[model samples]
Target chain A: MDPGTVGKLIAFCNNGQMQVPAPEPATDPRRHAADTWVVIPLYNEISVIARVVGELAAYFDHIVCIDDGSADGSAASAEAAGARVLRHPINLGQGAALQTGFEYVVGRNEADYIVTFDADGQHRVEDALEMLDLAKSQDLAIVFGSRFLDDRTDPGWLKRVMLKTVVWVTNLTTGLRLTDAHNGLRVIRADAARAIHLEQDRMAHATEIVLKLGRTKLPWREYPVELLYTDYSRAKGQSVLNSVNILVDLLVR
Target chain B: MNVMWIQLLLVVGVITVGLFLARPTGGDSHLALRRLFMAAFVIVAILSILFPQWLSWLANLIGVGRGADLLLYALVLAFLVFVATTYRRNVATNRKLTLLARQITLAQAATEDSASIHRPHEGTSNDDAAH
Candidate 1:
């Protein structure tokens, strides 16, 4: 299927949903929201994590934040904002936090889907909700959010080049062609999430997750989603030089 | 200039070790092989120190110039092997640590979840009282 048409289709569906005025509770597309868990691997984002969790709590009934031993009270802030907080005693990498979240969600019998979100407030809740809807409607086991599907997200030229290189490397390793590899928004069904065993504990886990998920041979698709590259997120973004570390981590293992 | 036999041997040895490092390590057999290699190295080191002339004679047979040069080459190869083994060990250790930390975090979260479920209303009342 052509991604261009799919992108336009998504835009059209979004507009259709917006035009609806006071739909009945029975007709709400988000009726299954209770079965979806939003897993956020939070770090030292005390400033914005409360707002992020609060925004997610509006749509998702279950929001779990894995606090990787933040020096700041980010965990408490997330808890106050109505999220289930899991605290790691020591600071592990984001990948480790993600794995922990997956395991925690998978242990519960009620969870049917996991939406991996970022704590930096770059990801849009509407995008996550749409991805989850696409997954359910299409019977997809995974829905990856891609920024390059449209021109809405414009990371700087250098950052774009670096991200494209990462996409190339991820495709080479995972045997799955994806427009964006490092976006922190993904919708993984419970079955697909159970298959992921991420050994890479650092930034390399992004590629590792794709590699493991691809090995499952489950039905997957890329959904066009715009990432809000705010100043806070930009400041916390990965540096180009860090790609060397990611390469080494992936190769050595 | 013709390449000496020692140069060819060193190149082949380094290449073989590099390829070996790339392979997934076997558990018991790999440990046994490493121990055997260490034992052989110790014997050779003692022999070289005890009879320096014998070391030079052996080095000449291998086309190396002197006993010191042969020892230097061996030391460099041993250092590389040490680095490779240390790196592998570190990766394995990190994996174990990650699993342990995850277990602890999950257990704590589960306990807190049960506690809140049992006294669900008390938590909200405490929050309201604090506010």
Candidate 2:
């Protein structure tokens, strides 16, 4: 795929939904390890971290695993699987963990771009790579990974309803009409990552990032990515009640 | 004007208990202030109910028209104070949590560095994680 022609982005009004662009066609394996960094915030995912890190290590050399006080051996397994693991003594929520990773990359100038991937197997490595390619190709500051971009994953009826409500609320609050607002798979340019700050240490951080993006000069793109929702990940993922908590966190604090 | 000694005792007794319960719980000054504010509200309401004439006397001294009006003003002021203090406390707690997270992250980095130093060849197999 010609990187420049990928996505065919056209910004418009509320009536027009930004057609989520498809991922770029396969290219040479992205070997420039000095440019891209992947931040995976791991909790109690001992069974999954090793496989996740191993796969990420194949495509990108800089894999940063942030262990959020997992009582399981997630950190050890990730480290053994060739990941630069950073740990927290206690659980500080996903927002804080991602911020810590962002600071690590932005503060040290480690990579040109940073990708936030899930510790669980719900997110696909292909989508992350594609987003990274799109961001680099378009010179965009951020590229958000979306599931509903195409008929990729079946997230059930209840989850589908909850996702729409969240997207609507997030769009209203953040002032950005994003197709999928709370998806974890995000690829951010280095400068935007440096300027961006995720302060809400809970799920509210997702909304915080979107709001920050709205307030920034960074240009962003959203690409259609497939989210492989496994039964294990489904059982461990955020609930609809957590969406309420995120809303309250945004409003009250 | 009649002075009921039993009424005075009840007022004093309730105020004392309320003040004691409202005492600061050591470190969290905001909680202490919240309890104290609630106690103040309860005590004032009790005093005014017991002696309307006494409340009116205080109101007149303070240039207020009615004792009920004075009580209403006090309640409003207490409620505002509670809200303002709660907001400040929440901000402080958020800042504290950020600091704690940063410290923990630093500690983790330090441990990882030391482990690499001690065992250069083990390649992250220290068994010091997730017990």
Candidate 3:
């Protein structure tokens, strides 16, 4: 695996995220990055964290990168890239990292919006910003970024079928019609986002989020986004069995 | 084909996994009970491997239909109990470990730049949305 690509993949590492970025001197409220906390769960993405976080910093101010016990200096790279870095003593799943980010924002009560972004290069910064705006303008509680919502990109046949199956299962269990069940980009309101506490410490958290939000009065929408599926990301993407495990986790736990 | 071979293969494969699990590591207290338990299984498994007909003979005396059937029933029951107990322990351990990791992350925040932790956002407007 390309170290940089793989580094982005495992960022499924989330710290008690949702850290408010230190504000810039002066900026437009519409474009303000501070009150919007972007949670980045990072594991061993030492190679690409700085670049990804740096690109994210262009739009949002407070970028919290959770380092889930990486042997490499992933946290350091994110910190250097103007993100607040939180450290986990051991490797927890990406779900735990996002939980940490959510809890941090809840604890501080300083953020207005919390955005969950993938550590993988698949996520586009432009898409995140647009989803953030849609969530705010439409007064929606959550804006889930869906690769299938629009035709900007294709995640390939096998991936499409896998994701569709996940979406189907998620909708069946949650009773919510979501175009994408496990895309890593999500923008949630502070209050509504706070209710999304994750117990599933692995990829199941994605489905778990759908279930949690579906039970609430939270209004949500799916925004179309693009995912750059390189040969690396395609190969490194989740195995089909992980979906079965996710289903079992959701049903049992 | 003789069913004995399948039973032998299954037991051998399972024992290989057991051997890996029983490999010694540093700082682990040696448990005599555990050693004894595994030793008993090893002996029984070897006995079954060596004397396949003995199980059927014993089973016949106990009114069981066949030796392989008796052995399979015993193995399945044992496996079920073992899985149930092991799963319970694994869940508990995972919960405790997750809590520890969560605490470690919550208690500390790292920034690339020194003196960046808790650096207040300047002239920040209202607390974004939620009060």
lDDT of 2: 0.77
Docking outcome class, model 1: medium
For A109-217, candidate 1 gives per-residue lDDT tens digits of 6799999999999999888887877788668899898898778999999999999999899999999988889999999999999998888889999999999999999
Model 3, span A23-111: residue lDDT tens: 12223433848779999989877767888888888888788888888888888888888988888888889888889888877777889
TM-score of model 3 (CA atoms): 0.70
How high is each candidate's TM-score? 0.88, 0.74, 0.70
Candidate 2 residue runs with Cα over 4 Å from true position: A1-26, B1-88, B107-131
Question: Candidate 3: deviation at residue A129, Å?
Answer: 1.9
DockQ, candidate no. 2? 0.23
lDDT of 2 by residue, A19-121 (tens): 5454446566664356899999889998888999988888898999888989989999999999988887778888889998888767656689899999997
Q: lDDT of each model, Cα atoms only?
A: 0.86, 0.77, 0.74
Residue runs of model 3 more than 4 Å from their true location after superposition: A1-30, A251-253, B1-63, B66-72, B110-131
Where does the lowest 10-residue lDDT sum fall in candidate 2 chain B? B1-10
Q: lDDT at A82 for candidate 2?
A: 97
**Tens digits of lDDT, candidate 3, B2-47:** 5565556557756654553444321234345446667988998899
